[model samples]
Target chain A: MSRIKAVDILAGGFVVLIGVLAIVESTSFDMGTSRRIGPGYFPFYVGVLMVLLGLVIAVENLWTRTASDFGWSLPPMRSPFLILAAVAAFAVMIERFGMFPSIFVAVFLGSLADTNTSIWQKLTISVAVPAVCVAIFKYGLSLNVDVIRWRP
Target chain B: MSDFASNLALGFSVAFSWQAMWYCFVGVTLGTFIGVLPGIGALAAIALLLPLTFGMEPAHALIMLAGIYYGSNYGGSTASILLNLPGTPSSAVTCIEGYPMSQQGRAGVALFMTAIASFIGSICGMLIMAIFSPPIAALAFSFSAPEFFSLMVLGMVAASTLASGSPIKGLAMIGLGLILGMVGRDLYSGLLRFSYGVDQLYEGLPLVAVALGIFGLPEVIKNAGQITGRTVEARSISFASMWPTRDDWRRSWGAMFRGTGLGSFFGALPGTGGLLASFMSYATERRVAKDPSRFGKGAIEGIAGPEAANNAAVQTAFIPTLTLGIPGDIVMAIMLGALTIHGIQPGVSVINNHPDLFWGLLVSFLFGNLMLLILNIPLIGLWVRILAIPYWVLYPFIIAFICIGVYSVSNSVVDLYVLMFFGVLGILMNILRFEPAPLVLGLILGPMLEENLRRSLTLYRGSYTVFLTRPISALFIGIAVLILAWTIYGMFRARARRRAALAAGGE
Candidate 1:
């Protein structure tokens, strides 16, 4: 099969699986009395229709010669990966240090995803932006938040 | 109607306060900042700040949030034309043709046209909102279950006409999305439909998780490999001029007006949303333009029409949400969630009971759009310069910001995990050429569909004909039939042409 067709087939299969799960779950419900249709009624129909659509797509993929313009290419993943890691670390520290310190650290570390930046410059920006934000949001406006939790 | 006018006066009184004006300014500025950044959307920005809003008056909070929405719409186009990356869905159509203009070194023209179109569209939509709101709001209050169901059906069917490459594929995607929309507990029975016994499954899919994963993560991966790569020749981004020339204005003004009409109506339609607005604006401009072939190439009209339609749709979408309590889009839904949390129920009665909120919100929306237009134009230079930053320096910061933003939504680690999973899913979907826009539409519209459909079905009592027997419902069904017939005929004709071509080749 052509790559595009193959991709379609795979996606269709995943969708079908999801449809089947929806159908089974909907069926598990009582669907209510004649005068009042249960919550499952609409979902049941939606699930069935989705499965049918997925089947149609799968069949079309099997029958047709898929188009040629289908591939995934890009620049690199290192910086993206590092940025993701920094965010994950920030999330980890958020409850401990609060929104103020955490966002700064994350943005600063994230800026480092570009290798050319000096460490001192990154640190300066990282600390400064968050500090200013804390003052504006916390002290000046009295928008409530824990600014210096661990320090106190 | 007199009550509405009086209430509106009250709202303006509150909104015109210095505190409110400053809040609006802050919101728009922050909104523009985030909008300039690729992959960071208004939803995420609002979600992060939702915590802060917990302490403020509802009107002040909503006005600020409204500013962010309009500001982001203005901001996203800058990145789209300059870097081929749309900051928001409103700007997606801009990239369809605007990016090519940038490649040809007319990025200045594209940027200038977009700003003008957006401003004009905003004013037109706001005018429409002001003039027709009383009547529209009154009409919306009468919408029954069947009407809502029909509206959703029309939206999903109309959605099929969006993509250009393959109409059938788009329909299939829409169907698949609608089915995904059915997942989770049946709202009436309290019965789980597809949870597979997982607790999180009970809530079904998180729209934010899905959106961030689908739109945000994939773009990151695509740009990841290029972090160190600098391919494009560094052309000087135009910082000198902000306005379009008179000739440019003459060409675009008609499109801008037509786009406002289309966008305002589409915005008022339940489930149709901004995606339809963007696509329809582009198609309408392409059809109406003197030179149709200029579309998808560096045509300034391409930028103008869709940008106008997008901003107009953003403004008009509030009509349904405020009057009928039916959210016209996902942002409206989130806004609804915020209002509901504050014990505020929206409807005709809201105009009488909370005049402060009613007029304040309406007036704030006006000032917010004006603020967005004023603040955004000068910052276009700053946004253009950011496009010059290398991918290596840009991608990591993007990923980090998204992570922090996602975590801040609920301050949950599980949310971060969900974000990562969806990001990977988003990347895979991109690689596979599956468009995630329909998936988002499906997810956002899923709950509403289930609620309305079940309500209609219960009223009919197993007769299925209520959809046809009811006047509004019948009209929708008839419309759906006509659309289907036309689509099928077109497909048949295309098939016949292909077969004849094959026969000629064989001979």
Candidate 2:
């Protein structure tokens, strides 16, 4: 199969899985009648619609050939992972270490995502970003968060 | 006339306040800053800044946010003209002619004309809003649950079909969004539907976290290291050289007016926005031009028309948002979300309840456009410099801001986790070629859709025919049906054409 077809199948399969899950979860609720619809009514109907749509999308490639390149190319994982990690770090550290240190750590980690940056450039950005953030969020915006806290 | 004059007086008085004016300035300046940069759109910018508005009055907050919406429209064309990068999605059409114009060293003229076009579009759209909104609001006042339900259905259908990409994928995304929106407590049954043991989700997903994760994170990931290292030459823009020639002016004036008209029509539609309006304007301009060959080669009308269309769409988008309480686009959805957060309900009654908000916002559009015109023309150098800022320096701060912004919303760690989750989902959606805009719309409108559905059914004693019985509701549903049928027909025709081509090639 072509790469584009593979992508379509994968996407359609994922959507179908979500639909099945929704349908299964919704069945646990009372499936009330059309008159006094239960909580499951909307989810159940929407799930069925989703399943139909997914099937159609999956089979669409069989009948029609498209010239546009829909080939799956791997996105650079480094930046996405590191940026996500940076967010996670801030989430984990903000309460324990406080805003300033958490922000500094997050910026430092995020700055590493760009492989093109020099160590000195990363360091400068890490320091500069947090300082400006502290000025803006803490001093300027007056957000009710601790700038620095040693206690967990 | 007297009532109109009095309303205008009230609007001017409220909008002219020092506090309102300052925030307007702040919002437009920040909007221009982000709009000049590629990748970060007004949706993401509004999501990022939503946390900061917690302290302000809802009226001022809305004015500022409204300023950002249209200000970004003005600023979005800059990068399109100079770098072939559309600063916002609506500006994508501008890049066709704009980049060519820049290549021919008419970048300054293109920038000037876009600003002027944007100004004219915004003014015309705002006037239409002022003149027409009252009647529209009055008409919407009679709409009940059935009408609302039908309107939302039409909106979803329109949004999915009209948006760029396959209609099927768009529908699937909307379905997914509707499912995701079911994560909170069920209002009718008092049962928590999908919260999975987390009490933080009782109020449903944190919109800021979801938006930032879905829109902002993916952007930061995609553009990392790409935006930096390019320097815009400062010598390119001379104030005296920015003026367009007489011939350019003559061609652009009519195009701008026509663009505004197209934008106003599309913008006032509940589901569509500036992106559709801009593309339509571009298509219309191309069709009407005496020599269509000049379009992709620095045609002034190409830039003027679409820029005007987008700006006009930005202004008129508020019509449905404020009157009908249905958002005209994703940004308006967020704006409505902001209104809800501030304990203000948006709908027909909003005009009656808060004339100051409705009128003041209208007046602010006038002032904000004036401010944007000044900011865009003379200070082009500052924005160009902003474009030169390295991504390594920029994305980190964006990361920090996203983290803090999400955290500030509820002071909950769960929201941060939600942000991370949506970020991953967003990247996955990107890979699958799904448009996130419809999903966001679905998420915003999902609960409302369900509420109205249940209410209408209950009111009519479970009769499904109530939807078709009401004239307005029936009209909306009929339109939805027609659009869906037309789209399916188009899809089938295209498929048949493709098959024929394939068979011919084989023979």
Candidate 3:
């Protein structure tokens, strides 16, 4: 059995990986002297610091016992995915379909995350949200995007 | 005194204009509306409105935005008191005592006192801003690249440690934010760091989109169907019942004043802001109370203290933002972004370059607070009704609004993708129990930090010792080192205590 707190180790390892990536990428830039510091200097040092900190965090459980549970439980993925999907749908369809359909699709997908709302309720929200958005963003604010774009 | 009078006169002349006053009214009304609604914050509201200000004069746009910022501080307390929902992060402390007071049928009184406390705090904070800002700006004029770099370093340190969560995690988030901020082309080398072939990212990520995604979207996701409709009891909120008892009055005044003082101190400090101030005020009030047991069960001091502190902090947060070109909080960062969008560079020279903008904004706070007091008191019923709107209805609108808000910023689909990216990131951070506030401070200050670091190094002819040798820079670095050392000590002590407890449990 792993005595290490899985959450801490995973989070810390992720940080270390990001820092390593930053260091690796930064080496491509000029490593000028301190007097005339290059673009890589600040990021390189920052990455090194991040790696050190991440290492300490990863190993912290060895020195001290944490009250937090040792086991790792995945966060409920349903709502997070649905919410991101809603936003992604809007982003993908917004330029092509314009404001109305994009927002309707976004709201419909977003409303599904609730799980308590009926299909009828979701449909109502989809229609109502787009209408309000059109009034506010299109008419009231006069945003530059087309209401129903068919072309780029 | 005469100079002060003349400055006030000029400020009044600019802020009292019909256009400025009208927009101020509109901003505060909208601010109060959103502030009463749960799961949405001033950051999202301000970002949503940023695009609409495109056609207005910079000063008027700023005055209105500032009104919304402080006004939300006032309005946020309403949700905390009435429904146990914090409208904004700063108001989270208000729910501790305010909700209990409401449950005991003192809801009206709590609302009334919060408004009064908010008024007092805003007035004091505005006065401090007026009195100290000129000298502060003058002092900032002498600061060079070394001093700025040290100051930013101190700021990042203070922000990461003082924010809610583990200090190490906060620091990690700051590092992550700095990396994200480096996505655009380096100013000196003109080499793109992390754009990954996306042309829209050449200027870096949009601040509005990132903020909304991180702060706003996660909130909606968490509370999607969780918030049901809440009904406010009629007898609990009559206008006649809103008056505080004699004991309530006696207990609250000192707490309000103490809260104001604490708030002004913390708000003026770079990186710390209203959220920390409010929590500190609540803690202080509980510590000093005659019977601490009254605290969680309807203590008037709890509501009075935090409400006052948050409002004061909101006003004084501008001190660093306008004077030093550094934001004191996330909202101030967005406001600074707004100034940049309007073609005004925020720094010490802002006072000298645009006296009207600085002075007028300060003066407008007086009117904004007065308007909020009226809006909160006589019109309390309207906001109470607003609380009854179901989360299902409210959140869908929020999602739609967020999508439109992000899309409108630069009219770019890529920014929308960035918004979605940060939204997922925000949810992940939440699961990991990381605070998002310091990350924002890091993101906004990252470029400035890099710029100052390079400038300082170049100026000193590659001498690393210049940082320690310079008096002001040395002072800032020393303070940062002291804070870091103290935090580490505290962490070790806590760990030791926890280990001792575990040993005792094992036995």
Q: Which candidate is the best by lDDT?
A: 2
Runs in model 1 deviating more than 4 A are A62-152, B1-4, B43-52, B80-86, B92-110, B160-210, B225-244, B273-302, B325-359, B378-380, B386-397, B484-494, B500-507
Interface RMSD of each: 4.3, 1.3, 1.4
Tell me what TM-score chain B of candidate 3 gets against the true chain B.
0.97
- As for candidate 3, its clashing pairs are A35-B462
* Candidates ranked, most accurate by lDDT first: 2, 3, 1
Q: How well is candidate 1 docked (DockQ)?
A: 0.35
Worst 10 residues of 1 chain B by lDDT: B224-233
Show where candidate 2 strays beyond 4 Å.
A63-65
Which candidate should be chosen as best, given DockQ against the real structure?
2
Q: Which runs in model 3 stand beyond 4 Å of their true positions?
A: A1-4, A61-72, B234-236
Clash pairs, candidate 2, are none
Instruction: Encode model 3's per-residue lDDT on B173-268: one tens digit a residue.
Output: 888888878888899999888677886787888988999999989989988877764666544367898999999999999999999999998898
Q: Ten-residue segment with the worst summed lDDT in candidate 2 chain B?
A: B227-236
Docking class of 2: medium
Q: Can you write out model 2's per-residue Cα lDDT over B99-158, one digit (the tens) per residue?
A: 998888888899999999999999999999999898888888899999999999998899
Tens digit of lDDT per residue, candidate 1, span B1-507? 787577668878998999899888888877877777765677656655555576678888888877788788888888788778787867888997889988877777778778778888888877776677677666655767887777667655655544333445556556656665665665556666665565565666654555565666666655554445434445654455445667777878888877777888887764456657877988988888888888778777778888888888878877766765656665665566567546686544554466687678778877887777666665566666665665554554555446544554454666776677666666655655566555655665567666777777777776668888878778877887777678667666766776777799996
